[model samples]
Target: MIEEIRIQNLGVIGRAHVQLGPGLTVLTGETGAGKTMVLTALSLLLGGKADPATVRTQAQAAAVEGRVVLPADAPALVRAEEAGAELDDDGSLLLVRTVGAGGDGGSGRSRAFVGGRSVPQAVLGELAQALVTVHGQADQARLRSPAHQREALDAFVGPQHRETLGRYRTAWAERARVDTELTELVERAQDRSREAELLRLGLGEVERVDPQPGEDVALAEEAERLAHAEDLRAAASGAHAALTGDEDGGTDAVSAAAVVEHARRLLDQAGTHDPTLAALATRVAEAGYLLADASTELGAYLEDLQADPRRLEVVHQRRAELGTLTRSYGADVAQVLEWAAASGLRLLELEGGDQRIEELRATRDGLDASIAELARTLTLGRAEAAQRLADVVSQELTGLAMAGAQLQVVVEPADAPGPHGADRVEMLLVPHAGAPARPLGKGASGGELSRVMLALEVALATAPHDDEARPGTFVFDEVDAGVGGRAAIEIGRRLAELARGSQVLVVTHLAQVAAFGDRHLVVTKSTSDGVDVVTESDVRPVEGEDRVRELARMLSGQDDSQAARTHAAELLELSSVGR
Candidate 1:
């Protein structure tokens, strides 16, 4: 609820500080006394458009500030914190808006601040939804809107119905998703077929080659060995000859094995004379054995080495085939094999595209059936709630002095399902008995429309809802525009009733309405003269005799008249009885 409002240089309100509190607070004054400027200040705080013309003459700028107390878990509070707004020491949010005077008589710029931190005007607008509901004469047009009617009926049905509506919306969204997927699959059937064909061809080529994990590397090694077989054979033979001197004893030099054996015999003969000679003989014998083993291995290698052109050509052809696979698919045989495995899986999926499409269609059909059922459920729920709402609001209209009027909340089938439902809800008014039901504003006067709106609001508020769903403050701008007498009193009573659970601010001219206010503020205008004459307006709360005089002024335009004061006191007394 708003705790206070401070406005400066705005309209006729040069500087005014209006203190507000819980319950119904009414603003009243004589014509041209700047009562409307109070609400205009509120509008600025609500992020309404700013007009430079609203800036007081000779003022550089117009500014409005508001202090609102909100619940700890309020959505508006959460949003404000998200925007880096800080709460006051008393836990109230401070909102401020300023409109600069345009230079050279052009349009001016507007700025908004929440909790002392600057924010976008749109942020203020977003917070306004949960902060207050403002009803003006122009809002009668909004009441006639079909969408708004649906929303009103839904709100009246309470949270359980809203949960049902949420379920239907979720199901509808899922159905849309399924339908989109099904359509895409059907439209791309030929593309899937072509993809499958390409995968199959690639797999066929890979299977024909039958490449192994390391085939390319192994083949390259074998090819190198075979290509140099002659050189390998010749090198082995030369090494063997050197190790054994010569197998045919063709060299004049002694064979390595024989030379070592001779050295061992000489050392043994001298061992009888010197022990050191015996150790040398043992080392010479070990060398002779190692030379014989080397000669045997070399001979074996020479025997195994051979040149085969046919085998070389076979290895080359195999390498070329693997290269072909590598060029298109991968870098080598191993990579090619990996690609084959992956493509095989892809081929399976592509081949099953037709089956998958059919499965999707089946799923979509099931969802369609479920969605249709939920839509019907929503329609039925709304229809039932509409009747209850109409009954209640019609009763409200009766109390508002439209004794024979009736409210008809009509629910008709829509052309197709929407996110809301498959029904169009409209509120029709029957001005009196035996009269045709007409859409709101069709045959109803401005006063009747105002009553209908008020009745609807009261009826909706009768339903239980948490604070988040119901705003804490409501502002009415002349809701008693064309209303008078008992009807005006009923309007005030309803406003007071609405305020039992929230804060209510009404801009009114009727003393009956003013009498119902828990707090009354009156705007007074005066002209001050100095070097230049200046007109200023101030808003001050009235009480006791002052309130009575203000109410008298509102009633008969003569505060000193005894008859008017008596009537004003009587209205106040009547308004107090029910409280």
Candidate 2:
């Protein structure tokens, strides 16, 4: 519940503080006394949009503040904590909004703070939704929308409908996902087929050639050696002739190995006289052995060398095949291998596309069956709730001087399922037994419509729903507009009855409504500094003689008149006795 509201530099209200409490509180004043500004101030505190034009002429900024009291475990407190708001020591929360004009031509900006902690303006808006519901002339207009009508009906149906709605929404979301998958798969069927054909062709070519890792590099080196086989054999034969005697050639006189052997023998024969010569002979003999081993290996290499054209042709053919694959796939053999690995995975997905489509379709069908059953249950629940709501609202209207008014909540099947359910709800009203039922807003006077809306709210409030806390405060701006006499009295009584359960505030010009107020406040205009120079609006609680005078002023536009004061006193007296 909102405990207090303060406004500074908002509209013509330079400064005003309204200390509020529980039950029905009424604000009344003469035309243009700025009684509406109090509601505006509360709206600002609730994160409503701020208009720079509403700022007082000489003020650089406009501000509104409010104190909201809630239980420790209330969802609002939870949300506030999530937003880093700190609660007061007494557990009450303070909300403030300031719109600064910068005292320049630049457009003004608004800021919000909750529980003394600065937060985004949107956070304030969220708390406001759970804290208050403000109804103005705009709300009466919104009641005409079918969408709003359905929402109202669902709210009236209580927690069962809310649960059903949650289930239906879950199914709807999953069905949407399945539909997306199915559409993608069906749309890309031809594309996948084309892609699969290309992959198969590439795989077939790779398989036919069956290229091995590192095989191409090894084959290139071998082909280069074979290409110069004749030159290689001649070079080895020359080296071997220098190492040992060449049997095929007579030009070579003595081989290196034979010369080294003679030197080693001379060294061995002189080693007995000089020990240094023995070490020299051993080194020469090792050099001679190395020369002989080199010649033997060189001769074997020349024998093994081949200059066959057939093998050379085969090597060139293999290189050409590998070149075709490398050019199509990658810059090198390694990169082509990577392409083959990745393409295999992609091909697997493409091949399974049809199977995936089948799986999604099956899942969607199963969900459809469940959703259809849930929709049926929701429709049944709505039909039952609608009947009870209409019956109770009719009973409430009878007390509000609308004895003949009949409210009908109609539920019919929708062409398709929605997030809420498969039913379309419409609230209809029958003025009397002979009259056909029409929509609530149609064929009804403004006063009659206001009573209907009030009755609906009362019915919804009295019934227990989910633990989700509703706004503890309700504000009505002239819902009694275009009303008078006994009907006005009934409206006042109903407002009081509503306040019995929660706080309610109203701005009114009717004395009958004002008389029912547990606390009466009056907004009066006065000039500051001098007469007729500058006017300001003042809001203050009225009691005793002052209350009677204000009520008299509302009753006959004459607070000083003897007859008006007497009537105002009588009205207050009767209202105190539940009139």
Candidate 3:
């Protein structure tokens, strides 16, 4: 419920503060006295589009703020909290919206705030759903739309029907997904088959070679050695002869081992005289042992080294084969092995494309069956709900002075199931008995359309549903337009009745409608001239004779006229009795 609204520099309203409460509150004034500004302020608070043209002349910006009280578990409260907003100690959430005048002929910029925290304008729109419902001439225009008609009927069906509708929507989405996948699989069959054939050929080549990890590196080393076998043997033989005595050569040259052994013996004899010579003798002996070990290993290497052309040929052939595999698949055997492993998995998948297509076909068929069943449930549920809604709204129409009029909610089957359902819901009207039903847009006048919208809103509000599904406040901006006399009075009475369960605010010109308000506010316009001249408006509550004078002005052109005052008093009395 909106507790109070403060508007500044918007339209003709320079500044206005209006207090609201939990009942029907009406705003009335002369045609140019800025009564519409009140509803404009409310619209801004509700996240309506802002225009720089609506700002007062010479004002920098326009701002609107509202204080709304929400229950602890209200959806709006939960959303606001999630946005890092805090509530007042009294559990009231403050909403603020501002439209800044764009300088240099640019478009205006709008901002929104909830509970004193800045938020996106769209967040304000989301909160508006559970916070308030606004109806005006535009809403009556929307009532003529078939989609809006379906929405109204669905809202009136309560929770169970809503659950059914939700299930149908979910199933429809799943069916669409499965259908898309199945279509792709069927369309790309030839492409997948060709891909599978290529994978099989590649796998066959890799399996034939059967390369192992590090085989390429090992083969390269072995090939190098085999290619230079004779040179390696000559080098090893020369080193072996140098390290030991060349007995087969019959040379008198001393070998490295023999020289080091003689040097160690000479140092050992001199070590009897000096300790430093003893350390030198031990070092020479260690060197002689190392030379002997190297000579033995070199001799073994020369013995093992043999020039075999057949083995060399085999190594060369193996290397050429590896090079062929590398050129086609990878830079080396390791990379080729990696490619083979991944391609093997992919080949299996491509080979199973036909089986996968069959599986997807089965899944799509299952989804189709489920979707069809849910669509039927929705159609049946909506048909039942349409009848109940039509009956209830028809009863409301009777009270709104359309006694002979009847509302017919027609649900006809569409060619195919849509996102909503398989039915096209429309509202038709029979103005009186013995008349054929016609669509609302073609049958009802502007006044009748307004009443129908009002009737539908009242019915939905009074329907059995969870509190979360119902808005806490309802605002009507001249919903009583094109209506007068008893019909106007009935509209007021029904508004008062609707207010019994929720907060209602109305901007009206009719004294009959204004009389039913628990609180009546009057907007008065005045022009001031000083250093800067400007026109401003003020909104204040009226009661006793003040309210009567305002209502008198509404009824006639003269508020001082005793006859209009008397008429206004009578209307108030009649409204009280009706209430």
Candidate 4:
């Protein structure tokens, strides 16, 4: 709850410090006397919009600060710490906002701090959103939106729909996830099929070519031989002719083998006469045998040296096929083979799209079913709680001076599921008999709307919440504007009752309302010199004679009048708060 508020050079107030505690504290003053400035200060601390015009004429900047105490483990506390805010030793949070303008004619800029650390305004906004709700005429406009209506109804329903709301939220989240994945898969279906087809075509090409490892290198060597076949054959035949006489039978040439044979015969005839000559004959005979064996092998090679055009053509065709495979698939036959092996596994996975799609569809269908079930459950829970809420709030309205107010919590089905549920909840009002029932958004007056919200808050305070935690402060910035008489008194009573559980601060002009304040603060303007030379507005806590004087002034604009004093004294006696 807010412990204190400090304002410096804001609006008509030069400097003010308002100490607060847990209860209904009322701020009252004459028109334009700066009672609203106190609320403006608190609003600034709550991250409300900043206006340069709100700054005092003599001040360069306007600043508002608030001291709030929260649980140590609260989410706001954690976020403030994350933003590097230093918490008080007692775990209180310091919230501050300042709006400054340049000395020249320039627009103003604003800054915010949480727990004494400078932070973005948005961080302060988030913390304020969690801490307090400021209800006034502006918020009455917000009450007209259908989304807000649904939110109010949900909050009123409380723990009744917590479980089903949780389930619906989970199912809805899963549905979104599955839907996204399924959409992606379907969108890529054609692409995967095209990819699979290309893989199959490439693999088929490789299969048809059937190039073996190292085949390219081997084929290149074979092609070289075929290209120079005639040249090779000629060279071989010439060498053979030198060893033995050509097949053309040229007897004029003396062949190497024939000369060796003649030399051996001559040596043998001489070796018969002398033993040394016989040894020379044996050596010559060995030379003749070696020459004869080589000549025979050369003759066979010459016969086999002829090349065929058909064989060469076949080799060229095989080489061309291997070349095509090498260029498209890989630089070498081995690499191409490796690609084919990997492609086979990839192809299997790509074609498995159908199975994956089916699985997703199955999961999506199950999620759809679960979500529908949860929606139905949430709707039933809301329907039950809505009736109970209507009855309770209707009772509260009766005490707030609307005896004939009838509230109807309508649970209408939505065409599609929403984040909250499948139903759109609206609060309908029938002000009296013969008054047609209309949505509170359209039918209720400003006073009635205030009471409606107050009634809802009261009912919800008693209802169990999922966490059973309440906001730190309830700020009613003259939400009691259009209410009066007993109705105003009831509003005060309810506020005082609410303060029993949490902090309540109200800016009101009604004495009936101000009389119920546990602490009363009156904003008064002090004048200097004659006529309207200058004036200053000051706000401070008042009690005893000062409080009676303020209440008397609020009651009849006559603080010294005995009749007003007597009435104010009676009001004090009648008030429930200080009593």
Give the best candidate by TM-score. 3
lDDT of each: 0.87, 0.84, 0.87, 0.82
Error of 4 at 380 (Å): 2.3
Candidate 1 lDDT by residue in tens digits, 1-579: 899999888877778889999999999987878878888889899888888888887778999999999889999999999999999999999999999888766458899999999999998998999999999998988887888889889888877778888888888888888888889888988998898898888899999999988999999999999999988877777677766777544455557777788899999899888989999988888998999999898888877777889989999999999999999999998899999999999988888878888898888888788878888888888988889999999999999999999999999999878989999898899999999999985778899999999998899788866567778899999989998999999999999999888899999999988899999988888775431211333577888899999999999999999999999989988997223
Descending-lDDT candidate ranking: 1, 3, 2, 4
In model 1, state the lDDT of residue 274: 92
Steric collisions counted per model: 0, 0, 0, 0
Instruction: Please tell me which predicted candidate would have the highest lDDT against the true structure.
Output: 1
The TM-scores of all predictions, comma-separated, are 0.70, 0.77, 0.82, 0.71
Residues 150-235 of candidate 3 have per-residue lDDT tens digits of 98888888888788888878878887887888788889889988888888888798888888898999999988888899899878
- What is the lDDT for 16 in model 4? 78
Question: What are the RMSDs of all candidates, in order?
Answer: 8.6, 7.8, 5.1, 13.2
Give the Å shift of residue 563 in candidate 1.
5.6
Alpha carbon deviation, residue 196, candidate 2 (Å): 3.3
lDDT score, candidate 2, position 89: 88
Of 2 and 3, which scores higher on TM-score? 3
